[model samples]
Target chain A: MTVAAQSEVQVDNAEVRVTEWRLPPGAATGPHRHGMDYVIVPVADGEMTIVAPDGARAKAQLKTGKSYFRKAGVEHDVLNETATEIVFLEVELKV
Target chain B: MTVAAQSEVQVDNAEVRVTEWRLPPGAATGPHRHGMDYVIVPVADGEMTIVAPDGARAKAQLKTGKSYFRKAGVEHDVLNETATEIVFLEVELKV
Candidate 1:
């Protein structure tokens, strides 16, 4: 699979880590399980396709100025569904 | 001073806490010190005045789609300087 997605760690500390994720059209973060509770802040308006661990698929409409949070152990694959680039800020808390 | 600033806890858990802050023109977060490391993602473009503990002051120009992080123990007063409302997402690490 072509790696059209990129992430940059803006902050890394003992308590939490902040990562900026950028994805072009048709890019994805692949399937992964979260080890820590995290929050996502969408930087740009777009849509994303989320593939769940049980093969469930859903569409997440991205809205700027809004954020979402989920607990650890959640598994999913996030794919960009728009024609433009998608960007967001991810903050993971490590207690 | 008018309390034109408001904050809502979007996520609170053992590892991390996420808060969304909104400030109107001339609003301020008051003089405070951070107890945990945190990251800030600006949702709206605006300028802010930061007043330090020792009476030092500086201007922070907000840019959309950009984020910043700082360690704990940082003290400052944040004031909105623009005519519009200023909103940002803050993620705090509890560890």
Candidate 2:
């Protein structure tokens, strides 16, 4: 099977934005929502726990070298449930 | 004082994906474009140089905690112009 790749086009007028997350062991990011559409990429792997807005809690093992996208509007808090430091990247389209 | 925040909505059927990059000093990831829309977040800072498809090269100091958005169709190559290790995150909505 062939792997899909990144897109190629001339996009305009969009500003660049980035966010860094440094989570300590068992620390939570608190409750938050995606104000703008953003992408999440993990540069480091840490056991993560995500709590949905409706109080649904989920835990999963996140690894580096993968990508995930959260919509422009979603409520959740991500916690680095591991004993080691967790780092990730969040990119957003600045309006 | 007011700061715009992340959005909140119940999105469906989108998958989570991630990719990692480990580049040596003066190393390059080759020429490629974004196949899907994605966000870029810098979790770590290093001197980065980006080259657009039209032979346009831009060098900027990328720090952790800033976000940027590249459309689904843009071809660019990013490099760490510094001697230090650089790390970042990319998130994309999987169709």
For this target, which candidate reaches the highest lDDT against the unseen true structure? 1
Candidate 2 lDDT tens digits, B2-94: 112122222224443444445557667667778876655555676667888887888877565455665688788776666876665555545
Worst 10 residues of 2 chain A by lDDT: A1-10
Write model 1 residue lDDT over B1-95, tens digit each, in one string. 65567999977877667798998997999889999888889988888889999989999987776778798999999988778888888888776
lDDT of 1 by residue, A21-53 (tens): 998998999899999888899988989889998
Error of 2 at A76 (Å): 0.8
TM-score of each: 0.86, 0.51
The alpha-carbon RMSD over the true interface for every model, in angstroms, is 1.7, 7.7
Q: DockQ, in order, for the candidates?
A: 0.60, 0.15
Off by over 4 Å in 1: A1-3, B1-3
* Candidate 2 residue-wise lDDT at B90: 55
Compare the candidates by DockQ and give the number of the best one: 1
